[model samples]
Target: MDVMEWTGQVYADTPIVSAETYVEAPPARVWELVSDIHLMPELSSELREVAWLDGLTSPGTGHRFAGRSAHDALGSWETISTIVDCEAPRRFTWAVGDPGHPSSVWSFLLQAQGEGTVLEQWAQMGPGPSGLSLAIEAMPDKEQKIVFVRLREFETGMKANLAAIKGLAERRA
Candidate 1:
């Protein structure tokens, strides 16, 4: 058997979701899209908007941003995200809520393969406070189901974002 077995299920035991897509463009082209946090609102299902914070024009390690999101289940909430990793044209990572005690950690990884770039979006849900935390507090026994559902929502959203990125990058190429 494989060392990692993913059966398309996410128990609260596994609070992560990731998706990848290939863009027939150089890493730089794809990077242009992924690193532009402001563009996320157009592609994401839950994120309503994002704006740079602390007078920063672009994200870099230690920079922060505010995001407004709305989900049918979780309703609406705003978060302050702090950039944790920034390697242009390769990777960008950030933590939501608090960098040291985040509700979630998300990353975009770009790898050059042949003439195209493989872009992967990954997210790990909290060990901190979030809507899920409230839900878990209310129904501790259904934690697994709640996490699984949220992860599935994340997977769907990431896939759509990747598709949008691919379309934009290829058209620009």
Candidate 2:
């Protein structure tokens, strides 16, 4: 029997779901796709809306944006995220400031892979009340299940986003 010890702590405050995809585009092009955060909604179908609280410029640490995301019945919700780190054509990370949030950070890391770019999506939340706060305080177990469901949904959405970006970049190339 292969016993696996799953001692990793539960991270409710900084829960992260991550996925990666390789796109047949140069790093520079990939940067153009990600660096222009405001254009996210235009480039990716999953991003319902992205309002730059600041102008269109390469985001810096502390830069903020209000965003809404939802592709189906789940409906869209507003979130304010602050860029904690930004490194062009390589890495960008942000943290959400929504009330009763489950995750604290979301990030994108890009790298040159052969004649293409590899894009990685990562999220982090702290350990507290599952990602859901007030409404589900009465039922912790249910909230746990909901968190799992949301993570899975987010994973699927991220794949779609990457595909959309790949399509746009390839078309331009």
Candidate 3:
């Protein structure tokens, strides 16, 4: 995993982090893993649970879902996310909070690589209010540090997610 350069970004900067891995399985198999919202808690350290909303059973553009997440310092919270992009066997993206001004955005991108697939997990922090924003408000002096640390945590989690997906896809292939 390549370290993301987010040294001094503030919350308004909307810092982004991403990690990628090559999976021995094809894009279709990788898509099955990435598109399954319920499987995320199994792979992510922060996410505790997820459920599709409004009777939806699968992912699609404009679909919504609720996710519960927990962090040691931040405790736990729930966010309703909207699917902003959905391209089967290619990409899946969702925005946490309001889609027009999301607190965060996350994505999984798949590209065919030889006989396998290259999968990348990407995330961008707030342009909207979030738990981190509350922390920043409490200690304005540490805004940069807070953002940097959170981005680091996102990077670490994204790497783990990609690794887990790779393992699962290969084993099932």
Candidate 4:
């Protein structure tokens, strides 16, 4: 895996990190995995749990979910996320902590590639407050380093997520 480049960005920069893998399965099969919010914790390290909110059972634009995440340095926290975009078998996206001004935005994109699929996981950080913002508040001078480290963590986590999804999708295929 190539390391994602970071240029010491701060919160306002809204930096993005993405990782992708080729899955030996069709987009439909891969979509079943990515669109299921309940399955995410199984593929993620920092995300501990997720559940659909307001009696919702599936993803759709305007639907909401709660996600609990834990990081060693950042501790544990829960955030309500709203689905900003959902296109079956192609894309699924959500905004954490308010759709209007989210702390972060996350997405999964899938494209058919020959007999298989190319799946990408993407994330963008900060136009709002988050655990990272708290850390930055404590040490303003370390904002750039904090953002860089967090972006690296996001990149690593996305790569791992793609790997796990690839394994599962291929096995099912």
Candidate RMSDs in order: 3.2, 4.9, 0.9, 0.9
TM-score of each: 0.92, 0.76, 0.97, 0.97
Ranked candidates (TM-score, high to low) = 3, 4, 1, 2
Worst 10 residues of 3 by lDDT: 1-10
Ranking by lDDT: 3, 4, 1, 2
Write the residue-wise lDDT of candidate 1 on 19-106 in tens digits.
8988999999999999999899999888999999999999799999999999888899999999999999899999998788788999
Better of 1 and 4 by TM-score: 4
The local distance difference test score of each candidate is: 0.86, 0.67, 0.94, 0.93
Q: Model 3: how large is the Cα RMSD against the reference?
A: 0.9
Model 4 misplacement above 4 A: none
For all candidates, what are the clash counts? 0, 9, 0, 0
TM-score of 3: 0.97
How does residue 149 of candidate 4 score in lDDT? 93
Which structure among the candidates has the greatest lDDT? 3
Give the winner by lDDT: 1 or 3: 3
State how far residue 40 of model 1 sits from its true place (Å).
0.1
Pull out the clashing pairs in model 1.
none
